[model samples]
Target: MTYCVGMKLDKGLVLMSDTRTNSGVDNISVFRKMFTWQVPGERIITLMTAGNLATTQAVISQLEERTKEPDERDNILLKTPTMFQVATEIGNLMRNIIGERQEANGVKGRGRFTASIIVAGQIKGMEPRLFMVYPEGNFIEASLDTPFFQIGETKYGRPIIIRGYDKQMSLEDGVKLLMVSFDSTLKANLSVGLPIDVQVIGRDEYEASHEHRISHDDSYFSAISAGWGDALKNAFHSLPDYSFYRGDD
Candidate 1:
């Protein structure tokens, strides 16, 4: 399992993904789930994946190969004029990968290699876009009402994003919000471990403007984890307690 989050802000996009993958309690290992492609001053794209590792890796490998071996194959990832088409191409690749795997493995393989992806980027002269692409090759864009997307162990961290996100917030604030959300999930789940990767793409920047990796011993993350724990304790204690019966005393 994994926990990957991508947020769309009025300023730009912020993405974070855990590097943890586990086959068993003693078999845990780290693997990066975030991939980015960019042509400075023209376009930039970032993808965060969750689900079966093999399927996700295959999809990424194919995309990476196409970009590098453009003479032998079309590099739609770079040549596409719109982000929508970029997403369309990726969705097609994911669908093809899953279909082929299932076909080769027989009926027992259905749904075994499914994966999900969040795609975000900007093209010159066009507004920044964010999308959550399903395993079925369909996707939906982020809008004002839904300004972010989460994949993997999303349930544990979703409330923080729902409560704290504001489109007008600064990029720095956006990063802090995501860190807290990831911290919460880390505390509640074992599969979503650290050495988390973060990327920020400022609107119209045409590339990632900032990138950071949060390691297990990262002082700032440790502080955030501890401080948030204390804050939650304080908040819980401050709430009024309810009486079981009116006028019982």
Candidate 2:
């Protein structure tokens, strides 16, 4: 399906998502899973999505529409005073969309219409925050105890992050950690193919300090992938040999 991660670091935030969607082995497509909204120096918001493409696209479209027609209704993204409020609004919208689709399709649509999102951003006068919104309109924020969140095909990549994430690390290191995580995921799962989208937001900047699209041929990613594999193999070999059979041998 997809792989999206949002990290809350001391400096700011780092977000990344893969762009591959597949209906079947023969039917595959690429659609960006990352979306961003900004008000220059005032605020910056980023959303990374997973699960049903239709549901996520509809949620984003509705949010954008509200921003354009603020006179007709409250533009939650623009009017919210804090990042917490922004997450609340997005959670409500996503829950409503999924509920409506399920109701329209009746029981036949049970599990087909669900989706989840990672919301990360900052508003003027506030610190950067990160959230993982569930399909049920509930969410959890990242804290010192858990400084990151990953959605969609998460298992294969989670260990790398758990072992490497450091809240005090620089954005550069954050990106490198994410690349290793993503590379591990890509090798194990075909559904998470890349052309990854990445964004780095610096504290107080209220704008993306760096944005990149990494394709399969990217030199740096290639090096990371190869280097990680070699390191893993070396570590496995360097472990002390088993002593259980030493007497028999």
Candidate 3:
């Protein structure tokens, strides 16, 4: 399991993903869930994946292969004129890969070989965009009404984002918001462990503006985790006491 988030802000985009994967309690491993492609000043794309590792890896592999032989293939990531087209190509590729696996296995019901992705980035002449791609190859983009997307082990961390996300927040605040969400998730679920990968893309930069890998011992994350817990407890205590209760009865 993993926890990945992509935020579309007025300033640019912020993305984060945890690196833990496990088959069982006794069998655990770490594999990066974030991938990026760039053409220097022309374009930059970042993909954060969740669900079946094999399927996600295969999808990324095929995309990379296309980039290597752009002349022989459509290579939508490189050749597409707009971010929307790039998303369409990725969705098509993802659907095809899952279909092939299903046929090979001859299975019907939703099985283990399914995956989802969060695609975020910007092109030279376009605004930064963010998308959440489902296992069925369909996707939804982030807008003013929905400025962010989360995938994999999402429930544990969702409230923090819903309460704190601001369209005008700076990139620094965006990263901090994500950290709180991730910290909440890490505390509640065993499947989503860290060292988290984070990237910030500034509007019009067409390249990564900042990237970070936060480990278990990171002081800033530690402070945020502890501070949130304390704040929650303090808020709970400060709330007005119930008036209907009879304490001595």
Candidate 4:
């Protein structure tokens, strides 16, 4: 399992994903869930994945290879003229991978090669966009009504985003919000471990304005975790007490 989030803000986009993958309590491993392709000032595309490690890695590797080979055919990195097309190509790749794996392994259910991805980025002449690609190769884009998308072990981290998200928030604040969301997930779920990868792309820049890996020993993350916990507890105590009996009387 893993936890990844992509937020679309007026300033740009913020993405974060955990590196942990676990088959069971005793079979935990680290694998980066975030991948990016950047053409410096021309384009910057990012993807965060969840589900089968093999399938996700295979899809990403093929996308990278397609970019290097030249655009004789319509590949994700080369054929997509816009972010939407890129997402469509990725969805198709994911669907194909799932289909191939199912045929080869003869799995009993629809989960063997099941995976989802959150794609976000900008092109030279376009605005930043975000999409969530399902295992079926279908996708939905982020918009005014839905400015964020999450994949993986997402439930534990979702409320924080819902409560704090704002379209006009700065990229820096967005990063902080994601860290808090990740911290919440880490505390509640054993499958989602640390060493988070984060990328922040500024609007129209077509490149990452900030990118970093937050390992277990990162000082800022440590502070955020500790401080957020204390702050939450303090606020809980500060809230006015409910007196149902008095209100009823």
In candidate 3, the residue pairs with backbone N, CA or C atoms under 3 Å apart (3 or more residues apart, or in different chains) clash, namely: none
Q: List, residue by residue over 133-238, the lDDT tens digit for candidate 1.
A: 9888889999999999999999989998999999999999999999999999999999899999999999989999999999978999899999998998998899
Give candidate 2's TM-score. 0.92
Q: Provide the TM-score for each candidate, comma-separated.
A: 0.93, 0.92, 0.92, 0.93
Clashes of each: 0, 0, 0, 0
C-alpha RMSD values across all candidates: 2.2, 2.6, 2.8, 2.4
Error of 2 at 110 (Å): 5.6
Assess candidate 4 and give its lDDT.
Answer: 0.91
lDDT of 3 by residue, 1-249 (tens): 889999999999999999999998788999999999898899999999998898999888888775566666643477678888777778888888888898899967576788898999899988898998888888999999999999999999999899999999999999999999999999999999989999999999999999999998999999999999998999899997777767766
Q: Which TM-score value belongs to model 1?
A: 0.93
Residue 198 lDDT in model 4? 92
Worst 10 residues of 2 by lDDT: 66-75
lDDT of each: 0.91, 0.92, 0.90, 0.91
Q: Looking at candidate 1, what is the lDDT of residue 231?
A: 91
TM accuracy, model 4: 0.93
lDDT tens readout by residue for model 4, 50-152? 9999999989978866546565533457447899999999999999989899888887567668999999999888899999999999999999989999998
In terms of TM-score, which candidate is stronger, 1 or 3? Answer: 1
Q: Residue 153 of model 3: what lDDT?
A: 97
